[model samples]
Target: MQPSDSQLTGVPQTVIIDPNTGLPQNVVIIQQPSSGPKIIGILIIIFGAITVLSEVISLGNTISFGGLFLVLSAVNVIVGVGYIAGGYMIQA
Candidate 1:
């Protein structure tokens, strides 16, 4: 799944306004949805692991079934490794 390109929503902070002057006072804006990256990274890692596992299982079938699976497994393993690396990068 992919994250949507949308504005970051933040926790609403209370503001104080003086009656004499009408302007926001002590408005603190908190940015970054702290858990977003971690959650996405975890999901990516899990998917990568699942892909690697399934392809590795298919590796066994190559001896008996043979052919296309061999090439497919090899390609999938590389893609899985790339996914894992990307996940770690995002987490970092």
Candidate 2:
């Protein structure tokens, strides 16, 4: 005879018992998520955006590449933010 899957889904049928009080004991380890990767990735993206924007602004009317720089800067910001968000989902 075999137990049904529903029977195994709930509380454990067998548990380790303490000798004195006969209490059920836990056997599994719990883990916590970390957030360091998300923080670092977000910061890198922010710096990249700042770098791109500063160059475009500093170039002023002296060059015709400011528009190009602005577009690339926008891309950097978007990608950086995306990485940060993805990191959080990974932790979840």
Candidate 3:
């Protein structure tokens, strides 16, 4: 029988031989997660909630300034979310 084209490489079909040791070696790579962004996001969310609550308490009788509180709460929430997202994105 004629040797197949792949066999022409002179390497074994089921094994790889390392050039330095003439032995087979297995290597594994692992990746770690970043935790910064997630933590920041969580903190922002919590802080935003607190700020909104406080604004509500301070406006108990006045309904006219509701918009102000709404805006402030929205900004705080957004910032918190951004921090969390950033921390996670920067992790190695």
By lDDT, the best candidate is 1
In candidate 3, position 9 carries an lDDT of 52
Question: Which residue runs of candidate 3 sit more than 4 Å off their true CA positions?
Answer: 1-28, 64-92
Per-residue lDDT for 1-92 in model 2, tens only? 87887675556577679886666874565778567766766665566556556655665553456667767666665665665565556444
lDDT of 3 by residue, 1-92 (tens): 88887766566678787786766885455868666666666665566566656555755543555777667756755665665455455442
lDDT of 1 by residue, 53-89 (tens): 9887766676577687677778889999999999988
The candidate that wins on TM-score is 1
RMSD to the true structure for each prediction, in A, is 18.2, 9.8, 6.9
lDDT value for candidate 3?
Answer: 0.61
Ranking by TM-score: 1, 3, 2
Candidate 1: Cα lDDT at 16: 77
TM-scores for the candidates: 0.60, 0.36, 0.39
Clashes of each: 0, 0, 5
Higher-ranked by lDDT: 1 or 2:
1
Worst 10 residues of 1 by lDDT: 19-28
lDDT for each candidate structure: 0.82, 0.61, 0.61
* lDDT score for residue 3 of model 1: 50
Clashing pairs in 2: none
Off by over 4 Å in 1: 1-33
RMSD of 3: 6.9
